[model samples]
Target: MSHVNAALTPRARLKIGRLIVEQGWSVARAAERFDVSWPTANRWAQRYRECGPAGMTDRSSRPHHQPTKTPQPTVRKIVHLRWKQRLGPVAIADKVGVAASTVHAVLTRCRLNRLSHVDRATGEPIRRYEHDHPGSMLHVDVKKLGNVPDGGGWRYVGRQQGNKNRSDTSGKAGNSHHNPKMGTAFVHTVIDDCSRVAYAEIHDDETALTAVAVLRNAVAWFAARGVTTERVLSDNGSCYKSHLWRDTCAELGIVHKRTRPYRPQTNGKIERFHRTLAQGWAFRRFYNSETVRRKALPAWLHEYNHHRPHTAIGKIPPISRLTNVPGQYN
Candidate 1:
């Protein structure tokens, strides 16, 4: 495989090769058109001539031989011990009479390093998918963030002060998920699969009513920009499964889809958004008060949707994926 900093991908190399080898283009012409160096173009041309299409594919750079590698019989013994005893590298090393590192290397090469990978209880690997159109599917989820106190709390002060803050706040807050007077706030999030356009609002509670309201607002927000929401993807939380939430989806002409039990990856988009939200908003600043922090969400959201580059969609802002919009930023 090409290194991370490699100048061209396999397809680009193939295209360059096709232009030079098949179309009788000059090397200088191929290099100029592909925006690659002459040496690079020559190398690609040579590789393509030698192996045709197969040469364009990434190949392992591992050496042809390893003199220090474990012997085949020893490797077989290591594998046998790992399977029969279900032990880790350290334990297997003692039994197989090899270094722990060597056992680990053998296990890794054999694809038996992690027992969880082969365990029946772990389930099959998840197949990631994305909706083809904007608003075709929106991943919805809620994340709870503890309200930051006045002038900030532990994050600002020392650990001792943080412990004191925790003790002081624990006595005042209500309900099961305890915290100080800052109280937990729920961030209801909605993100479109195709464009990665996101909507979020912090509310006091996460309920069927709150979920329904957020969906309505998000749909309206998308509608203004000409993206008609066609479906919603959510985890099977109590609020998501509520009849009110169902009726809300029906009224909006959206098909509501839920992730499989305990399989949150099905709704991975919003889950990933929650991580970004935490870093960009909840933890980005030392808010003097929860109210002040709440006010900052709109600005941060604007930056995310209109300014920040998203990797999945070619490092462009999510709004750029919307149709009929001119370039708004570099």
Candidate 2:
């Protein structure tokens, strides 16, 4: 492994060694000439005498002795349990009579700590892809948020006093309370790849028709700002796969793209947007009512698009990268 701290290459090391040996330069002189430490120059000269050119190459820094290390058989057993049974470190430790930390260390050293690193049946690395242009790809997703109680809920009050707050808001919180099931609002979002500009709207449901409507609005939003919607990326949800969704893409001349099953990161940009949306808008304030919170969405989005700096696109506002749209946000 080439390390950033390695000041000299193998070739340089060999040349210095030769200068000290073949050219008969002193260790101190060779060290001074090469701008290396005397100890390093001396070590190189000694290594060259013992092993010649091959010794000049990079060598593993692993210690020769590891007396208290886990035995090979134990490691093999642990690996087998992890790969075969798909057991976690704690379970593996319980089965193998080792500490959980020990099992974790073994797994990490074997490069098997993350299950995503390899396929269970066949150990193959997962491949990731990225697109270079902003408008070249877009990710669409829907996030569900529960309707807040009339005033505020448990987040404002303590968890223990949450029921009291709900009772105060809903007028005796019980099975008989109106809409006791707790209705949900779906937030449909579209995010660009390069600039990460996002447009979102809340809806009653995430049906195919609703998704299409959101997509059309999002596409238009991006278009107004100078991003062309060339590709639509989403998860394999029913709404995304429906003919309604496909036909909408056809009408818009967008290449409808679906992530591989169980791979949400394939549409990672919008997924990350949902997380930001939750942190920044949904949970950022104590709203008197759901209507107040809903009303605040546009302001937060305006800030995110026109003011908040995004680290991915060089720590500037997403709108800063806009080429299609000119003039500043009023």
Candidate 3:
């Protein structure tokens, strides 16, 4: 009698082969019906007759051996070196006598990329602090300095509010507004928050256009000195809030911050600086003319940065407190 040839497991194949031979089915017929080749059917038939189902069972697919796999000891060394030295994968590989690529593999297995480490002080892995870096912010403002006389009269530029072209012959003539002869000049100044380096420009009018041009020049000046501005803070004035000023900030990628209205203390750093400039430079002593006062600004600025001592900065120059080198172990 004829039976069906089925696709079967190894043991079933052996049994099926025996049944096929008992029924005397042709090899080609068994092959076509069982979806197997004639050689496989023939081999199964031989295995069943000689060794039975035990010999027909399938063997494992894994290879018996490999040639050059990395040793476990080397892998352990790589892990130890990476943790102990905090070294990069390439450095760790060099220390452990392995290929750089091998080091990368071990690091990947251990989840130890160089970027994975974090700073304990700031809790930031990649970002830096504003105080730790230069070019974080720029401070700008207009300072009203006392007048200096020239050619037997105070050199006047704009509307001399209380004093403009006066000869204070009296030894006690110190107040410029009561003198009625001295004229004040407004000095527009910009200082880098990171370096405390300052730039001052004398102007009769603090208009929006003047302020914009001064800022542009100040930006270039600071750029030359390795100081750049990521942001700028200023008082809330018509000049700063002008459309042109807003456009300039946008074009220059400067985030602008304005002090609260009527709150001069918000920008007290520059305001205090203005008072210091009036007391220390412009009004420190009597000058012959506005030309003399104007000419002396550069020298005063230099002294302010390099020579003068600042109480806020531990009796050091303003520049010293602003800029610091990184990784200063001492």
The most accurate candidate by TM-score is 1
Q: What digit string (tens of lDDT, one per residue) describes model 1 on residues 1-330?
A: 676887898989999988889999989999999888999998899899999998998878799998987999999888777666678899989987889999999989988888854433343323458776787898899999887655566777766776565556433564475434666799999999989999998999999999999999999998988888999999989999999999888888999988899876667778888999989988886776677889999999999999999998889999988862444112
TM-score of 3: 0.50
Off by over 4 Å in 1: 1-126, 163-180, 324-330
- Local distance difference test scores for all models: 0.84, 0.83, 0.70
lDDT of 3 by residue, 270-309 (tens): 7768888878877676566667878888899989988888
Regions more than 4 Å wrong, model 3: 1-132, 151-183, 321-323, 327-330
- Give candidate 2 regions above 4 Å deviation: 1-86, 90-103, 114-126, 159-182, 207-209, 236-243, 259-268, 302-330
Per residue, candidate 2 scores C-alpha lDDT tens digits across 45-156 of 9999889988998788899999999999999999988877778999999999999999999999988899977554444444545566667888888899987766676788
Clashing pairs in 1: 1-59, 169-180
The candidates, ranked best first by TM-score, are 1, 2, 3
Q: Scored by Cα lDDT, where does model 2 land? A: 0.83
Report, for all candidates in order, the number of backbone clashes.
2, 1, 8
Q: What range of 10 consecutive residues in model 2 has the weakest lDDT sum?
A: 321-330
